[model samples]
Target: MALPEVSDPQVLAFAAELAKNDGLVESEVLATLEEASVQQSILDAIARPAESKAWKDYRPIFISDRRIDDGVVFYGQHRELIDRIAGEFGVPAEIIVAIIGVETNYGRNIGRYRVLDALYTLAFHYPPRSPYFRGELRQLFLLGNDRLAYPIDQLKGSYAGAMGLGQFMPTSIATWARDYDGDGRIDLWNSYPDIVASIANYFVEHGWERDAPVTVRAVRDATARPVERTTLEPLLSVQQLEAWGYAPTAPVDAERAATLLTLEGPETEDWIIFRNFYVISRYNRSPLYSMAVWQLSQAIARGAAGDRP
Candidate 1:
């Protein structure tokens, strides 16, 4: 039923039935849903910044020389963990570290949102993606039951309701997370090993390629037009890209296998993307986010090179 239709006795009855099916206490579920307050926050977040502005605001938060350097040094510090995860899941250490650096700055800022509040607000009241949040809410409840951790008082992440070290959605925690440290708990909230392992698992499950490059910068010309941003699957070759006047900065082993991406930069700037670029986007859907990860990863990679005095 729709929001208004949720008042229907039939809808209430169905919710009641669902509660029973999910092994939830019916009264408790009703109380929780009734007291749930997601509308205000959803409205606030929606009515606030535009995506571009949000990107701009978030831009300065990432993509700094210092951050890049930190990433590089951090990668070295965790080289063993990264290597282990890479060997286990086939995800590169640089990308995984980049992801961790991007999501929480190496477990620095997880979030302040209440998991229940965020999920509930978006689930029942945020109409655009209510069904998705609703599913996440269900997942949250199931995750809470795993006995390793409970969602009730857990601190969640930003406006969209992602959680903990990796900023994983509740469903992602249940589905893709792992207990990598042999502690018998998938503690993405704090454990570095679990966080690293889970992130690697996410990339692997999503098809990260160890042999692939993340992205490349293209020299833009006045005649440049829109490059096709296709599905994540590989399609174009490096030679084909050169034909389009965009080439990889480094030598690519594959003759012609990459995706093209165009991004807006400071002062009418732009960039060309590659298959590895799409992999970063898999973690965060935004192109700006992927760029940040790539830039930060590059920074981190440099720091790991022992350039620091």
Candidate 2:
């Protein structure tokens, strides 16, 4: 089928900028832009991300018996690299693996849409985040530099244009990704060392504190104030929340900054999330995504209730 042409002025302006700033052949940029098609399913999926789901619904989706099992196996197989990456970056290996597990199921599902299509479709057609996706589309072109192992047109990723095992947005790949294996290329898709180190690097760059808590169960009381769950930052300190009758399930520093979060789904759950939790959210900007990574990492580290660690 003939793909519909994209003639949106803003989108065409994007292509012109790509050619002018990035040194792409003008005709080539226009051709590729024209070749890209609008994917309605991608648009729909982008509207309802798993991160918006209830904790109960979102938890099982990323943290499953099989996923944890796979995480353990992944840890074993990449033990040395995982350890080195963690030690070098001061981020936990389990947390590193958990991000990969949650993002792409340990590379089992690294997305299916052509990244070019995903970005272009969203950049021009999706009105709400057009400017953002247009920026991503520009980064997508930038990612085609030496970072990508394949041609940009051939690269596949999530509907949101996140690529590789880590599900890096194009800007992320451009700025934070690395050639950990020293292979002269940053291939987030198939390089384990590159993927591991790149993900750890992202956390370190985003201020992940080592040997600190990600979250603690909040002891809710009648005095507990209503928390804006959508807010990702920890504005309250451990002592402050306790004063409000929301104590941690475990002891915490009185001065440690945390934010109260409540979960609704299979059961009522609340917690005081720390900065590390906030760092994880920077990758996806969703409280549920960070919580899932935190919980799944704990489960992976300890193993299932009946399974061995």
Candidate 3:
């Protein structure tokens, strides 16, 4: 039989198929199908081509007015949670707070996408990573049916299906999310403890070095050899950086690898990253992002340590 061209039956069938694939047949899946009335415009919008530009779009979103102010308040409200989680995770509180600040404005702006809708939209319609989204959909289904949350009513997030305080993708939440609040549920959506611990956990899992520096402020000469951005991995030795006229303010006694980072600041700014700095990149994969976290971490630490930030 030919599949229906209309949205209703087609979406219902897709949801049923997805549920069957995940062993959630009968009642659970049929209920999902009952709600599967697709809006062609939303689907069309999803199918529309995405901009090839990355640095331009993603950067501006981070620097937006709402994000920065929300980040500040998030840091203030979660002061104790940040300190405790940081100590436990061996990452500094500022980095932890900065991550929450960056990802979801400390839970104030987690997202609005329904897990079912967003995952289904991306899993089957969005071709850029349909397979990945399909897997995430599976995870979301399992997460939902298992009462792993407060039902679908409270589970909303980003268009790509990331959810909760950290804006974690379903797979990331399934694997790395924790019930730090001791409430038995890993509630990243509303629990400050869970969010705080989850961010720190993500950093540690990605190899943050305890008590080691995340980045080193640096200076480079105008005559320095131009760096290939693709080769931004932290591999050049500090001595090599020195030869290129880069210096780290954090003080390393030689024999350490670093990456040269040029950032667009209110004024031009540069930083040389140590191994730990590279670890921060694993969280967001941007030098500017990592630097922001590091700087914010410094601010939080100073404030907590009784110094004015």
Candidate 4:
């Protein structure tokens, strides 16, 4: 296919800046950007992310019988490696698998849209987050310079440009991805060890505490009014939530910070999510996603114990 003209002044300016900053050949940089086209479907997908769905609908998509079963099998096959990685990183093995499961279904589906097209379309056309996408576009060029495992135009990822098994963005791939196999390269596509270490490293870097509690069954008093659900980070301490008559079913430190989450449904389930839960949310910044990861981790554990149907 012939390259399309990137006539947008912002895009042309960015291309020139990237060429200057990265020491990339200007013509090649423009040629690559010209090869990228605005994908309307990518725009459509971005408009309604999985995070926009209700917990009832979103839960079924990731916590299905097949996914839970696959997670059980995945954990079994990678037990030695996962365990070692977990021990080394101080993150739970189930959490690691659950993160991978929630992200890509054990690397079975890592999206299909060309990463370059996705980033270009978003960086120039998506107004709400154009600045963020612009940075990712720069990171993409940096990653492609002898760092990307595959050909630059050949890498496929989510519509928003998250790549590989853990759905890492270009910046994450550059800053945190490791050569876990010691093969002189970091390839997230087929390198399980690299993927494992990368995911664990991401969590560790973002403050995943060793053996820390993630979430707990929350009980609320009638005095408690539903707080805002938009907060993904831990904004309230356990002590504060306790004073508000929302306490965890399990005992935890009063000093530990936590967040309140209500799974929107007919009945409306509530949870007292801890700091670790907030750390998981750092991966995607959605309470629904973090909750699903925690729930799926429990389900996989149940299946491993022959308790899941």
Identify the leading candidate in terms of TM-score: 4
lDDT (10s digit) by residue, model 4, range 176-249: 88889988767889888999999999999998989888988788888986576567677888888878788788
How do the residues 1-309 of candidate 3 rate in per-residue lDDT, one tens digit apiece? 333333545446655676567676545654653454334454565554233234444456555545555555666777677777888889876677767777776666776667667777776676688788778877776777443556753467777677777778777777778788787787877788887788788778877779876667777788878665565567777788878777776678567777677765455666777778887777666666766667655655555555742
TM-score of each: 0.83, 0.92, 0.79, 0.93
Scored by lDDT, model 2 comes in at 0.85
TM-score, candidate 1, is 0.83
- Model 3 clashes, total count: 1
C-alpha lDDT of residue 289 in model 2:
88
What's the distance in Å from true for residue 166, model 3?
1.1
Show where candidate 1 strays beyond 4 Å. Answer: 1-14, 46-51, 54-58, 151-155, 220-226, 230-233, 267-272
Model 4 misplacement above 4 A: 1-6, 225-230
- The residue ranges of model 3 lying beyond 4 angstroms of the native Cα positions read 1-22, 30-76, 265-268, 303-309
Cα error, residue 75 of model 4, in Å, equals: 1.0
Name the top lDDT candidate: 4
Report the C-alpha displacement of residue 237, candidate 2, in angstroms.
Answer: 0.7
In candidate 1, which residue pairs get closer than 3 Å at backbone N, Cα or C atoms, i.e. clash? Answer: 38-121, 68-299, 71-300, 72-300, 214-276, 214-277, 237-256, 237-257, 238-256
For residues 103-138, write the lDDT of model 2, one tens digit per residue: 999999999999999998899889999999989988
